[model samples]
Target: MDTHFIAFVLRALAVRLHTNRDFLSWYEHTKPDFILCTNFLGGSVIASIAKRANLKVPIFVYAADVFNNPKAGYCSKIDRLFIPTELGVKNLLSQGYTKEQVRLSPFPLQPSIQQMEKLSKSEARKLLGLEDCFTLLLNLGGEGIGSTALVKQLIKNKLAWQVVVVGNLSEASKQRFHALAKQLPGMSMHTPGFVSNIGHFMLACDVQAGKAGANALMESLSLGRPFLINELLHAARNTQTFFLEYQVGWVIRQPKQQMITLKAFAEDKTRQQRIEYNLKALPLQFDSDQFVNLLLNEVKSLAD
Candidate 1:
């Protein structure tokens, strides 16, 4: 695993892969039917190896996030490519893949979201211990990085809304939030770090303030809740495109812009209803069983 040793080995393997029999003798003994690669760079290298072997073995590449591949046709080097978003499909096409090679599939959601118990807003609010006041859910997807600033801003300003900040990772972050909560006597806020029952909170809040990550996007769309995206970067940019295409949510750019947007959504019931309607109109969702079946069938065919 030394960097110099790895570079030297790759060079030696490239020069004498077949002649240097011991370098990769494991492949001959193992004779894997196909190689599936989840890692971005490793998959491309593995595919190249299969190509050099005259493709006796096939390659199946799963794109981890939307537009995550760095190289052109990196996933296309494989026999089959599974991309999770329609935007991802376009990215592959731009990278020079044929229509036959790529398949758009749903990103697998958690069991909770798949078997999500549909709750009326009142019921969901009761479960989250939220009052009937305007409610906002602060979830920055699985990473739990952003939203501390927004949390303090709302509480310090004493915004008349119930704010539930879920899924923060570290204890330090949680403490900072709790400490801020104590400073404001009348402000309504809740901080719960990383819960499996995020599905409940998703249904409970009026607006989901977060980044454009897949889980948050899918859950918001599934629950027919408007997602007020807090940032768009890297893979999140692809999510922004999807939201724009469907009019599912507002992509926040400036800090002041989000506050203005939130105020409008808070004050206007009709606009809130409109945003939720757009999110529901989209066909995006997570059917984990069906997604798993697709992968299984592909694997079975290769194995046969």
Candidate 2:
């Protein structure tokens, strides 16, 4: 039988499994051999229910954060704890999690990013209605962190390049940038709101200026863009180190630093080319088939 994933609404799930009899009824109806949760709350709660009901089902959890957050008290109850990077493993180990319980796994990417067809930068820009100007992608991620002033600074100073600043799930943010796009004709500017095709945008842009985040970091690498991640977000250090060590990207904390880096990048084609070559050469192993097989193997092992 083909393996499929199921979602449980936490509120309804809690009420349904409030008693052992209720849990048994639910389990019998579903016949699940185990559970795998993406975050701490769901995993912790599920583990508790299984234990209380004397259910021997394995609980697997993929902690999304690069640094181990102490709130994930459910690690003790989990049969397997998957961490994304070696740095993550070190963090978890330092917190006294047993080596046997932890497994190194790839950072989970959205299906859209994983399945996106490779497109040339020009083709991507054309699709997005951008002109031939040097394209810069300004994303503050889904929650719209550090959106306002950073964008204004870029628009004011970056007169040479075309910048696409996305509001990313914030209407107020979208309106704010959209207003700037009208006013800043000197620098070709586009303000889009909460784009679903962000991976494509990453592909289209020559450079990325955003938070040092997992999705942004990975998407930039996946597309070979020069990532200009914020140095202040300490949670992203693991990926930052990997990129810096591999000579793929940089962390910039200030607007002045952004200009200095971009100026250097513009003048240094050899350096940029080298970084691109290194990026393409990295063993990403991001194929959908391979990831599906990996998940299936993990599930099968638990079943056995």
Candidate 3:
């Protein structure tokens, strides 16, 4: 069978499975008045099901991608689309979506991050058993992609700083970090994979170096720390722009230039203070219920 045909068949099977009798029965029993879908194609299927049932449910989509281009037919079924930033809104507008169709909302945040108590740098360092020195946090999300290479560069350059590596690190990466810590007494390194108190870790570090993920960027902003981007995923390009526009972070354009950039950033106290000043000037911390309230108001308006 042709690869595309096989993929089409599997997708059809999955959709059919999703709208099976049992699933339909459960969905009907729930009697949902409003629907919010995060997946583009999935939202289309859900909208069709609601239409078939003659339910007057309002369908909304929360898209995180910087460039979102759902088929016009699929978008027609959606009542409203929510995006996290103005850049996302611009992307949708350029794709021919009406301004009324796209509304900007705060990026959804983790519950732990929202409820986390603010910690002073000294307090956070004490809690994490980190030394009072220049600290760098290398986090590239749970998969730990592109992390080992950055760590290798940092080690090769021998920039003596407290380095903490987080996320789902492979055993090989852990061993490498351990070996380096032993070999170089001046360089401090700790790899605690998948920490629950990641907000604290972010607090304890001077700069966050990793992928330009929305969640990480938001957390770094709330914590008033500059994010150093080493890897730029295509999906997070807009997030990188956001950081640059706000002057709250630095970007390492080339992998080999990581050390030189870090060295410069470390030496530039004026730049550090400027970023901190900008962070303080911006409104970052919000009550956890803000997003929840936004949803409730939207749903209530539909009901009215």
Give me the candidate number with maximum lDDT: 3
In the range 42-93, model 3's lDDT, one tens digit per residue, is 5656665555556788878877453343443244445677776676777767
Clashes of 3: 0
RMSD of 2: 6.6
Quantify all predictions' global Cα lDDT against the true fold: 0.70, 0.68, 0.72
Candidate 1: tens digits of C-alpha lDDT, residues 207-246? 8887767567666777888888777756556666776787
- Superposition error at 212 for model 1 (Å): 3.0
By summed lDDT, the worst window of 10 consecutive residues in model 2 runs over 1-10
Model 1 regions lying over 4 Å from their true place: 1-35, 67-69, 72-75, 140-143, 155-157, 182-185, 299-304
* Candidate numbers sorted by lDDT from highest down: 3, 1, 2
Backbone clash pairs for candidate 2 read none
Candidate 1 clashes: the total is 1
- Write down the TM-score of every candidate: 0.79, 0.78, 0.84
**Which 10-residue window in model 3 sums to the lowest lDDT?**
66-75
TM-score quality measure for candidate 3:
0.84
- In candidate 3, stretches whose alpha carbon ends up further than 4 angstroms from where it belongs are 1-25, 65-74, 282-287
Error of 1 at 250 (Å): 2.3
Better of 1 and 3 by TM-score: 3
lDDT of 2 by residue, 1-304 (tens): 1111112234235435645466667887897766777766667666767766678778777766644533434335567777666767777677566887787776666789888887888888888888866777887777775645555665666555777876454666666666776656666767785788988888888788888766677667767887877654644556666666677777777776676777677568897788889889865544445545556777778778
